[model samples]
Target: MEDLLGSYIIFLILLFVETKGIPPVTLAIIILNMFIFLSPALGVGEVCLSVSTTLYGCEWQRLALAPLHHIDLDHLGFNMASLVWKGSRLERRIGSARFTFSICSFGLLTGLTYLLIKATLSFLLSDRFNLDCAVGFSGILFALKVINNGHSCDGNIPGPFHIKKRDACWAELVLIHLLSPRSSFVGHLAGILVGLAYVMGPLRMMINWITGKETSSVRFAECCQLSRNGHPDRDSDGDCQSTCLPRHRRQRRRC
Candidate 1:
């Protein structure tokens, strides 16, 4: 438990440093590589599940908790490095707190979704197939990429970047096909849906509610108005003069 807490603290520290403009990818890759190398020397094999079972005396039932216990120092280092870079860039643009929250929330959501899908599949295939425990950071990475691709805008404007959404989605689809050919497409699809939901669902609502501003194409015009006039504040005539006067008041002013 102390080791687990320590590892998490290190991750947070790395994340903080990454947000401050330090590139942490190389460090992550190094850590993961070390784990890969040491696992064999430690007689635990390359499979993380074996190491966890040997070290902690846990069963396959605890696979879901493996990520918390088994620190694939190398794989996770590399994964966190990439995510930190990507997430930090996004964070810089969107503000650190919001970006951090988005990444953590999306990761948790993806992890839960992966677990549910794996559990259901395991139950369904109990008679025919024996599924081994699987653990990795791939799902979270995929989710982040999907959300970033889908929700990205061209300099805070909308429409022109809409085409990129389709392109990004297709790129991920192709990559999944090439990489995890035998993997269930449902999991990937779920990740994509979850990514989209993070953008268009809860994250969007939370940001809007907290910042009192819209962050979607559907509300682009409204956002423009708010930006121009300042939100939650009205002009003398009760018109949002930041962008334009209200329709009724325009007529009244003319009269």
Candidate 2:
């Protein structure tokens, strides 16, 4: 997790450099140092400790204020750098601001959901077992994979041996079979659901709302008919009149 955080920090720095006049090559070097070298040196234990202390310890405020400064490089390691790199590339293609927001939101939501479920299970089975100390990028990674593969509805990539239609469904089934007995799978499932909801719900709404600024969902022919009858085409014209006005004006007298 610390490694992931380090990568995020490096990406942010690269963004800053791009905004300025700094060379992109320099940013690449920084990325290599932070992700490839520093991360493995730090390992997983330090990363978990950092998260626990920053989010729940007495010095939470200070740690939260400057988490990058406090990350322990000596206790972090990479698990699947290649997969993360691919996911990061996909995220860049999706647009950095949107990707960043979605990733962070999914991570937080998945973590909270896992914590709640574990807590509930522990209560229900009192003294039988204890659930504590969970950490991994599996959830966020799964979420990114889902988003990159074009959401749950799009299904999986079809190949000679791949399943068709409900591709995502099959991939998920395989994932469950592979990871079922592990605690991390719970978080992974939560993240997948969060990713699907985000893409199909809020993110879809936001993108449509933004792009539909000068148009309505109503068909153009319907708009013309309503407008010609002297009644406001409230569904379309009212919102899109400006977009259509120049063409309309060019065909008629201005008087």
Candidate number with greatest lDDT: 1
Cα deviation at 2, candidate 2, in Å, is 19
lDDT of 1 by residue, 95-161 (tens): 5555545555554565456556655665677622224333455555566665555433223223544
Let me know the TM-score candidate 2 reaches against the reference structure: 0.47
- The runs of at least 3 residues in candidate 1 whose Cα sits more than 4 Å from the true structure, single-residue gaps closed, are 1-81, 123-132, 154-163, 180-190, 206-255
| Winning candidate number (TM-score) | 1
Among residues 3 or more apart in sequence or in different chains, the pairs in candidate 2 whose N, CA or C atoms overlap within 3 Å are 42-73, 42-74, 42-75, 42-76, 43-75, 43-76, 43-77, 156-167
lDDT of 2 by residue, 188-232 (tens): 666677656645567446644654422212222222322466554
Give the root-mean-square deviation of each candidate in angstroms: 11.2, 12.0
Worst 10 residues of 1 by lDDT: 215-224
Please give the lDDT score at residue 112 for candidate 2: 60
> What TM-score quantifies how close candidate 1 is to the native fold?
0.48
**Candidate 2 lDDT for residue 107:** 56
- lDDT for each candidate structure: 0.47, 0.44
